[model samples]
Structure formats: C-alpha cells, structure tokens
Target: MTVAALAEVADVSAVEDRHVRLAGVTRVFGRPGTPKSVHALGPIDLDLRRGEFFSVVGPSGCGKSTLLDVLAGLSKPTEGTAEFEGRPIDGVPAGVGVVFQEDASFPWLTVADNVAFGLRRAGVDAAEIARRVDYAVGFMGLKAFAGAYPAQLSGGMRQRVCIARTLVMQPRLILLDEPFGALDQQTRLLMGDELLRLWRETSATVLLITHALDEAAMLSDRVGVMSARPGVFIDVVETGWEVERDSRIVSHHRFGDITGRLWEKLRTESLKHLRDG
Candidate 1:
C-alpha cells in the first residue's frame, strides 16, 4: 500500500482512549542561527492506544531513535506536543519505562536488587519493593537467577533483567529502542517471544523502534514507517496479528505481506536519505 493510503487509514482508525499522542511534533538540533542546524524528526501525528503493541520501522539515521527519545520525555520537541495519558510530557514523565539497545543492567547488583532499584529510589516501602521485585523476576523467568549478577547471565538473560527492572516500575508506557539489536538472530527471536509473553501479562502500552522488518511484523499490532531525516511518520501498517502472538507468527502467510509493504515505503526513504547525504 502507498504511504498516503496507509496514513488515511490511520487517521480514520484513531480513537479516543489514546495512551500517547504526538501531534505535529518536531525536533531540531544545532545552533538556531547556524547553517549547520539539523531537523531531526517530525511534525508527525500519531496515537498509541492503551495496551497496544506498536512498532516503528525505518531506515538507519531516519531519526527513529530521536522519535523514541521524544516519546520517553528524554528530549523535547521544538514544536507541537507530546502527551501521555492526557497530560503534556514535560520531563521524564512518571510511569514510563525505557529500554535501550545497550544492556542497562548494573553488573554490581544482583537481578532482584537491580529490578528493585527504581522502586527503592522512589522511596516505596521495603516490603512493597520486595513484592514487586519478586513478581517481576518471576514474570521474566529470572527467579532461578535472581541472586546472580548480570555478568553471569547470557546476553538474552541480561536483556530480560533490563526488562524486569522496567516492569517493576509498573509503567503505563514502555519504550524499547532496538532492544534486541545486539543479539544473534536465534536469541533475538526467543527474546521476541519472551517480550510478547510479558506484554500479555501487563497493561503497558509498548512502542518499539526496530530496523528488523520481520521483528516489527511479528511483534506489532500496528507498525509505523518513517521517512528519512527530519523524519515524519509516513505510513502505519496493520499486521493483523492477534494479541496472543508469538514467534510462531513468522510462519503465518500475512507476516511476509506486511513486512514487504513496510519495506516498500522504507526503501524509497532510505535511498532518498543516502542520496541527500
């Protein structure tokens, strides 16, 4: 499908119970009066529904990371607004969790302590922090290794530890920026299944930024494709995958079709970025 057509569908489908809303949001960097200034991301309009799994796929350097940062309140938009649960996001909004491409685990801390770190910082009662930590550790299948440090775990297990830390915070929105990019393909797929299981168990609205087309198709209910730098959301493709989706979804016939459609839009923008550079 064409970008325009996909955007039209998105507009028509957007409803009232939005968990996150970005309206005409844009981000720019460099000195305002300088010729070197760069416009990094949108004047984009997008809505994420409560508990929805939304993935974003785009070419490298298409400002996908910038978009994720804006959503996480790590960076501010130069124009327009980013709202979370009906309030404007000013700075590090509460109940929002972010997982990056790098391993965020603190090697000095045990898995259970790491998961409880955020809660402890917030001055949550000791008993409540322990309870949440225990629940999150079990949820991520790290109960067996709760006392282990990050260095003792495999790459996938470390990522799970990172996720468990975020989960203990009970975030209403979770932002993942290429969280599996460092793993091997097999491990990446396994982590995807694990993520799906976690998503199903929580009420968090997830926004994942990934370059892997198949990963996006397998995990997302709707995938947004972005244009080259000064990035704008060009299209939103529906994967039509059920909420109970898993790695088995790669075997579904429609998976290829959705990924292909996303690539069609992404390829053009990617080439455009290369040429402009």
Candidate 2:
C-alpha cells in the first residue's frame, strides 16, 4: 500500500453530514461514603460536526479524559444524553474508534497482525482484512516492520501500530486521548503530522484531548478549553475547518496571541478551582 493507494482507501471525501450532539452531560466520581464525591464533568452541552477536528485542553484533573470516556461510551453520564447521528448513545456506538494515551498495541501480535486483529473481531472477512491491513500499514508507513512484534518496535512505531489497528475498523468517529503524550518531542511531532494527514484522508470526526495548547491549535478545527476539576467549557476558539497548513503554526505571527488567550482562560478557571479546593 503506497501513500497514494492508502489515501484512496481511507479517503472519506464523500462522507455526508454525521455529527455528535451532547446535551447537559455530567459525570460524578467517588464512593458512596467518601468525603470527596466530585463532579467530573458538566452538564456540558456541545456538538461536534462531521469531518471536524476538535481538541479539548485544560489543566490537570480538569476531567478532559472523563469527557473522552463519555463519548467513547466507556462511562455513562449521571445526567443528560449523548447522541450519535441523532440517536441517544446508550453504549459504545458502532463505527467509533479510540486511541488511548497508553500504548494499546497488542504485545503478543506482530505489527501487521495487531492491525488486522480489530478488523477480524469486527467480522470483516479475511481478504478484506488483508487488504485493509496492508493499506493501514502502508498509510502509516509501517510496511518495513509489518512482521515485527510490539516488543521489537520503538515507542513511536508501536503507537503507529495502535493507530493502524483503529483505522482498519473504518470508524467514522475517532477519539484520541493524548495519543502522542507518551512520546518524545520530535517523535510526537512526526506522529502529529501523520495523524493530521490520516484524519484529512479519512475525514473522520475526530475529538482529540491534549494538554498542549499549540498542538491543539495546530491540529484542530476548534479548540475547547475547560475549567479545572468539575470541568466545564470556559472558552472555545474556532479555526476554519477544511483548511490545510503545511507550515509551523506556532511560528506564525498570530500564534502567540491565540495561545496567550487560551492560557489566560485556563489560568482564570484554574485559580477558581484552587480557591475551591
């Protein structure tokens, strides 16, 4: 699977309107008798458009990860509703994929085998799995190491394997919870570029969570900032969707201005949390 070939398979240019809607979503954390029962999320009302790249950023303990779980249907809300394609999300929605912060590539499987595993579980036939696996491996440029086990790959390569596995499922909605946070700076950037390219090619509805403001701005169609602990949306900044940037966004003249604005919003919310604590 060459880059051009994989691009063809993953291309989602024809996908029509597919959006997720969440209304008054909330989650609580703590044991029954605990003194520290806490609200991890809103009452959050939000909408993610089809083929959009959205990112959520906030201070530590701000429940950014919690939001991702709710979307993934890994955790149900204590209140409100989450919906896909206009239907209430009662459980893990079909055609949804996730990439975690931790390495999730199967340790025992070869890179190609790991990528194929998810497709197999989804009941895709063997021929289709082989075609899709090769396409994913080629798309992510993992062809050289397709036979390598997870233990034999570097951190970044293993992460690509994780991504390839997710892609083979041909999901329409993808959630990434700091998928590149575990890598070193350079590798993270490379992976980020790869991810952006892949997203553009797939046109998947992506919701990425990151602590890095610059990363969020560079990759997202909109960036949502949340208040610390007991999370709520403090501000959301929209960058035009369907635009492509090959240059470094941070080095641009307006970069500092946008980043500073996000910083202050986060800082103000964080201060409130500290005072409450």
In model 1, the runs with Cα more than 4 Å from the true position are 1-16
- What local lDDT score does residue 67 receive in model 2, on the 0 to 100 scale? 93
- Leading candidate by lDDT: 1
Over 1-277, each residue of candidate 2 has an lDDT whose tens digit, in order, gives: 7999877665543222548888999898875237888888897988888989999999888889999999998988888899887777878999899999999988989999999997888788899999999999999999999999999998899989989999988999999999989898778777878888889889899999998887887778899999887788989998653457633665776667677878888888778777877
Write model 1 residue lDDT over 180-267, tens digit each, in one string.
Answer: 9999999999899988988888868999999899999999999999998878888999888778779988988998899889999999
C-alpha TM-score for every candidate = 0.92, 0.89
- Each candidate structure's count of clashing pairs: 0, 0
Q: Which consecutive 10 residues in model 1 have the weakest lDDT in total? A: 8-17
Query: Scored by Cα lDDT, where does model 1 land?
Result: 0.91
